[model samples]
Target: MSGDRGAVELEGVTKRFGSMVAVDSVNLSVKPGEFLSLLGPSGCGKTTTLRMLAGFEQPDSGFIRISGEYVQGVPPYKRDVNTVFQHYALFPHMTVAENVAYGLRQKGVPKSEIAAKVAEALDMVQMSKLAERKPRQMSGGQQQRVAVARALVNRPSVLLLDEPLGALDRKLREEMQIELKLLQSRLGITFIFVTHDQEEAMSMSDRIAIMLDGHIEQLGEPETVYEHPSSAFVAGFIGRNNFWQGVATEHGIRADDGTEFVASRPEEDVPNGQPALAAVRPECINLSAERPADSNNVTAGVVAGVSHFGDVLQYVVSVKDRDLLVLTPRAHAARFQQDDNVFCHWSADDVYLFSARQADIVMTDGDEEIHDN
Candidate 1:
């Protein structure tokens, strides 16, 4: 490992499994101490990419570099990286301190050095008090911390986390997210996290590479990818969106239902008259009793359902043949009720227009469901 900084680079990397192409030609550059996430649904090749980076799986083509050195044939133990899997994978019989000291002991470090390093690692994760407790006696969160400590004991330049928080309950997972982020910031080590949860990626990643069908569909900061998606798939996957299939127009799109979308800036070009999709995020659509003067982006609907989520309220409005999801601040959400007539309107700036290349992936059979951020 280069002691200066942990910089990783993947150039035109490709991986295959028999007849299946798990990861397409992918290029990524991660700066030292940066937190980057490989985010996508199951079977999108996120885990494969992470495995390749950890040296557990070699790429079929292209090359990988770690800390400025090409690591094409380097084995997992030889690479300057360590991985924490979804399962804690701690030895059940080993105490917390013993578990953390296993790696150093395997490498034949001095007993005095191993003890000091084990204590430091346990202290880093606030698990020092549980150093004498076996994995079977500790809580899930504590076991997770031990797993992290074991990885950190090696002091790898880059840490690969594959859904490390996936096993915990929602609340504990959220708490771990904060701790892990703070830990990364404190250590200044490069972290490459992989997960299928969009919200997790958005909250933890400095930049996210959203993969789909073995290739990265888009790569950007959370806000950039959410507000200005490169493709229809990204717009739908990053967050909840109400999509309207339509034909591209000079300004925006004309929905098949006759609704017009005049976007100030379209995310993609569709050669005017080509099939396209126009999307608006749930929070962008405002519900009102009176229709706005601007007719281009206004439509009528009936409130089909309402769901309260602490400070936010989500509404399912039935419009013609489809249901549109809208989110509003709870303080401002009392005006509408189920079966009430309402007008849904949005600003052109909030509209996102894209070519319908990935419409099949975005559009589902039922109404789009809303998930809390």
Candidate 2:
């Protein structure tokens, strides 16, 4: 592995599996030392894209560049990158130190140098104390740390993580997320992480490439993608949203459910009377006992259910034939009970209006799903 700048680039990359295109003609540029995440649902080509970068899968068209060098025919071991898969894939019979040294030994590295590198890698992941433990004897989180250490031992310019923390319990996964981020920052190594979990991507990535149907749907920082999604699919996938199918109007959309929206900041411009989709985030909606005076972006509903999260309250309001999710901070929640009449209102600025091109793909029930384009 070379100590070069870890910038990566993909130019018009495409891959097909028996006529099923896994990665369409896609282009991307990753900056050196940047933590970028490839995020999307299953079959959205995020993993395929990672494989191509790792030299495990070659693109049928286009090309990839790692550390400023073309890697079209490069083998996995020859590439200046290391991959940490969802499964740690550690040698069950080997001690943590031996497992981390396996790659170095295979490459004919001197035993003296390998030991020093292995010790340093284990220390980096805080696994130095457990260097002699076998995989079967250690906890999942501890084993994962060893796996990371093994990858880091080679000193690759770029590290690729494919849902590396997916196997851990929620609390442990969160703990690893913070630890990995801090480690990446300290190492100043470019990390390309692949995960379908939006929260993981949002929390750990400096920028996220939201893939859809073999292409990049949106690429931006966590806040940029969440606050201003490029499409309805991106919006729905990034967070909980209430979507309405309707026709575009001068000011906004008039939903088929008879509710009207006035979006001062519509994401797309749809000509009047054309089909469109309107979206409002759960936290953006406000619930009140009295109807709002404003005419637009307000609807009468009855509280269908209420659930309490640690610091927030979730309310399911039934308006017409649909249920809208509303999230409020516990400190400011009005404490509406089930079956209580309430009004759901949002500001025009809070509404996201887009063309109905993705109407069939948008999950109206607040579920995250990205269908094939």
Candidate 1 structure, TM-score to reference: 0.96
Cα lDDT tens digits, model 1, 10-55, are 8999999999999999999899999999998789999999999999
lDDT of 2 by residue, 1-373 (tens): 2544799999999999998999999999999999999998888998889999999998999989999899989899999999999999999999999999999999999988999999999999999999988899999999999999999999998999998998999999999999999999999999999998899999999999999999999999999999999999898889778888889999999998787789899998889999888889999999999878987788999999999999999999999988889999999947899999999999999989999898777753235443312
Clash number by candidate, in order? 0, 0
TM-score of 2: 0.96
**Residues forming the 10-long window of minimal summed lDDT in candidate 1:** 364-373
Show model 2 residue runs off by greater than 4 Å.
1-4, 364-373
| Local distance difference test scores for all models | 0.90, 0.91
Mark the regions of model 1 whose C-alpha exceeds 4 Å error after superposition.
1-4, 363-373
Which pairs clash in the backbone of model 1? none
- Residue 360 accuracy (lDDT) in model 2: 76
Root-mean-square deviation (CA) per prediction: 2.9, 2.1
